[model samples]
Structures are given as structure tokens and as C-alpha cells.
Target: MHDMQKELSTDELMGRFLNQLKDEDQLTEKQKRIMEAAVKLFSEKGFHAASTSEIAKEAGVAEGTIFRHFKTKKDILISLVAPIMLRFASPLLLKDVRKLMGSDLPLDDLLKQLYQNRLQIIEKNWSQIRLIIQEMQFHEELRGAVVENLFGVGRKLAEAFVSSKIQSGEIRNFPPLTVTRALVSMMVGYVFFKFVIFPDEGMNLDDEQEIEIMVDIILNGIRNKE
Candidate 1:
């Protein structure tokens, strides 16, 4: 079976693969400091622009200490990939969807809860998300992982929900994939427009208002029903 097809829990896989070093005392304090510094610097500056010396300075370690932990500056960039996948993508792909699906709340209420949960997650991990988005352009591995683990899982979940709703005649009959894409696109566009494109102006709607407006728009098209 393919690695992707394996049923290993993300936490278990991560612990087995990543924590081994930490458990064996192979990961030193200096390495931990370097990783933290690298995450911050790489998030703020693109990988091409970030420097080992700058990372070392931020970590309060000698420049050579970086090489002791990482073979090259590029290794530091690569290191960000696993953590980004484990910390950010894994929760959305593996955990949040399960909780959302199991909830007894109504669809609209559930969506609001899920939206808030996602928003909080994004706000807390904004730097890491920014780093992944920035680095994805240059790294094929990062791009593939985002496509396979993040967007792919999300698309699948959305399709499942849309299909169920359509089967029950709760929603208009449309291609499940198309509906999923449209819904996801709308939410992503709203987030990008608010945070990335017009951040200086601030969010136009508060959380509750935003949820209400978004839910209304999604459930009912822009066309007047009358």
C-alpha cells in the first residue's frame, strides 16, 4: 500500500518519525532554538532571502551551530514542510472534519462553529501558513503536499456534504464537485480579500456578522428569489 493510503494516525506517525530525535537526545537545545528562529524568519522573509547568519543571530547561537543540526540552509527550509503539514494541515484534514461531522448542531450552527474554529486556527498559525504559501511556489514537495493533504481532503469532505444535502432535496441539484468547489472558493475568497488584499482597512464585518452574511450568501444565491 502507498504511504498515503496507510492508516497511521497523524500524531502517531509524527511522533514516531519526528520525535525519535528528541527522545534519543539527538536534538540539542541549539537545534530547538534554530528551528524556532528559522520558523519566524522564514515566515517573515522568503526562503531565498532568509540567511543562516540571520537565523543564528536570532537563535543566539553561533552560525556554525546551524550546520550541526541542519546539513545546509536549504535543510532548514525543508524542515518547515513537515511541521507545517503536521501542525496545520493534519488537524484540518484529520481532526476538525471528524468533529464537525459528529456534532449534533444544525448545519448553519455547525458551519459557524467550524468557521470560528478555522479562523482561530488561522490567526494562531498565520505565520506558519504564510511561510507555506510563500515557500510552495519554489518547492514542489510543499506544493504537492498542500494539494494532496489540504485542498484534496477539503474538497472530498465538501463533496460528501453537498451530495448528502442534494440527495435529501435540501439543496438545489448540482454537480457535487462543482458545488463543493464553489462553496470553498467563496469562503477562501472572502478570507483572502479580508486578510491579504485589504488587511490595512481591517475586516468589514465582525465574526458573527460575517458568519451570518456568508451563510446566507452560500445557501441562497445572489439572485432575488422573488
Candidate 2:
């Protein structure tokens, strides 16, 4: 087949797949309306307490539309993950980190910028984050995809950064992977605890303060004392 023909074929396949997903019995216009309503209802009421009829009414769709799109109402709840991940992953992957850490930016400034960026991302996606945490116990595949797509990229990027810093003699001589995991664990744990575990009294620390504390703790252990 000609290259152009192959490309056209691939495009057609993708279009068909997308259309199928959109037009799924449970995902038609009415179903989408219901799903949107369900998401809001679920967020406010919790998934277990939210009902299909309530979602349908809120969406201005019949209760049957909800069932048509998703065999069970729980499926609508699960579907939110895909859209959330799709919206968030691009920025996380493609944002210009190098520009943020340019030569003019001091280490403290760079760290502060990075932390604030991460914090903003987490805050924006807090709903999806909550959904994943709540459902992971029942859905191993969802948990795996979340780890693979989200944390996996983070770990790779962090490992590369740590390796470069160590090579430049700006950081300590710990194993790159180990240091990356430790740093990520520290940052992720702080975010998870502050936003998810204790949102009522979220960490009120300013970006600079949080970055300073993290940098001080990490640098103290990693910097060559010589």
C-alpha cells in the first residue's frame, strides 16, 4: 500500500474507534449528559449514594439513557478517569522544564517553581485523583495505568534530573533511581496527605516555604560536606 493510503487507513480506523466510543449506547448525547450530571452528583454525594434517576434528571435525560451508555451506573463513574487523564497528561509530559530551570534560575528558585507547578497540577486534578484512590481497590487495571502513565513518567524524568545533578557535582552520590524514588515519594506523600487525606486543613505553607523545607532536607543529606 502507498504511504498516503496507509496513513488514510489509520486515520479512518481512529475515527471509527472514537465515533464508536462516543456513540456507544451508554455514551450517546443523552448518556454524556447523564454522565456529566453523575460526576457532579457523585462528587457531591459519593458514588455509592448517587442514583441514576437523579443523574438523569439533572442531565435532562431519561434514566434509561444512563443505563444505555453504561450497563451499570458504576460504569459511568469509572469512565471519568479516561477524560481526566487525557486532559492532564499532555502538560505534565510536555511542559518546558528546562526553561523553568534555566541557568539564571537559582537552585532554590527552580525547586520552588517545580513544586508550585506540581502542586497546581494536583489541585486541578484532585477529583480524578480522589476517584482513582477510591476505585483502585476494586480495579487493578486502573491502578496500573495510573501508575504507569503518571508516576512512571515522573520517575523517569526525576531519575534523569538527579543523574545529571550528580554528574555536575551539585548533588550527592546516591543511586539515581533510589534518589529519584525517595524524592518523588516525599513530594507525592506530602501532596496526597495535604490534599486528599486532610483537605479540610490543607497545608497552608507558601510555595517558597515548602520548597525551602524540601530542598534543605534533601540537600543536607545529598550535598558533599567537603
**Which candidate's lDDT is highest?**
1
Predicted candidate 2 versus true structure: per-residue lDDT over 98-204, tens digit per residue? 45744466665676677777777778877666766776565555566666665666667777777887898876798999887777676787787787687665667
Models 1 onward score TM values of 0.78, 0.69
Q: Flag regions of model 1 displaced more than 4 Å.
A: 1-29, 88-93, 203-205, 224-226
> Which run of 10 residues does model 1 get worst, by summed lDDT?
1-10
lDDT of 1 by residue, 1-226 (tens): 1112333343443443344323215557887789779889987887867888999999999988887777677666555556556654565445876678566667777777767777776767666677878887976655665777767766777788779878978778999988887776766776777678888654555866786778778787678879
The Cα error of candidate 1 at residue 224, in Å, is 4.1
Candidate maximizing TM-score: 1
Against the unseen true structure, what C-alpha lDDT does each candidate score? 0.70, 0.64
Q: Whole-model lDDT, candidate 2? A: 0.64
As for candidate 1, its clashing pairs are none
C-alpha-based local distance difference test score of model 1: 0.70
